[model samples]
Target: MNSPDVSALEITSSQACRVALRGPELIIEAANKAFVRSAGRDGFLGLPGWEAFPELRGQGYLELLDQVYRTKKPFVGLKMPILFQPSKGAPMEEHVTDFIYRPIEDGSGHVTGVFIESYDRTEWARA
Candidate 1:
């Protein structure tokens, strides 16, 4: 039997709602199509995570990211509730998702960024 191709795995992973944030400020470095759709907009690249999703502030999400980055440990949130603002001046919408915050480390073992992945579970959670 043959092992799976790493590039193929990357492609599959990119299909999910994923985003990569860099530095302690958590600047949005990269985001996938599913992430854009889930965010309900684009142009997130280059913005701080808090700026991209202001509603997330004071919600414990940012703190969680900070914790993961600081400790270089991953956090798994199952069926977590998140409030998102689809657009400017829009009301916040509640969403439930399963999310993971994985710390990205450099060659020297210094945490430099975070890899975020989430799966929406709104309908299932509501049902």
Candidate 2:
């Protein structure tokens, strides 16, 4: 058996890396460009509110989110199916699978927020 490259930086998928605050002030400070796009929204610098992403309700994301929030550890989505809310008049919603969550922190090393990355598996699958 062969091992994989441990030090490889691959952009094989559309990734999302986000960092924000937790608690009553749950503010989504920064989300990578890919997340902004996959989320089908912009200006994610502030608390966009979970309600905005109606698709996430009742999904396993809540559990993963909780872990990230509490532990400030990285969460990952291995071939995770995702649905993006479409804009008004849009024919259908956009879908993506596979993403990663990398936690961010302040200089003091407190549990800050997480960096979200979405990988468009379709691209690689079709290749």
Compose the digit string of candidate 2's lDDT tens values, residues 1-127.
2212211133223344333434433466545555566556665456544644556666677567667767766777776655556553455554546766555555566655554555667556546
Q: What's model 1's overall lDDT?
A: 0.82
Q: Give, for candidate 1, the lowest lDDT window spanning 10 residues.
A: 1-10
- Which pairs of residues have clashing backbones in candidate 1? none
Q: Per-residue lDDT for 1-127 in model 1, tens only?
A: 2212223245235656888888999999887778887788888789999998889989999999999999887899999998888777889999998998988777667887888888999999989
Model 2 segments beyond 4 Å from truth? 1-25, 89-94, 123-127
lDDT (CA) for every model shown? 0.82, 0.54
Candidate of highest TM-score:
1
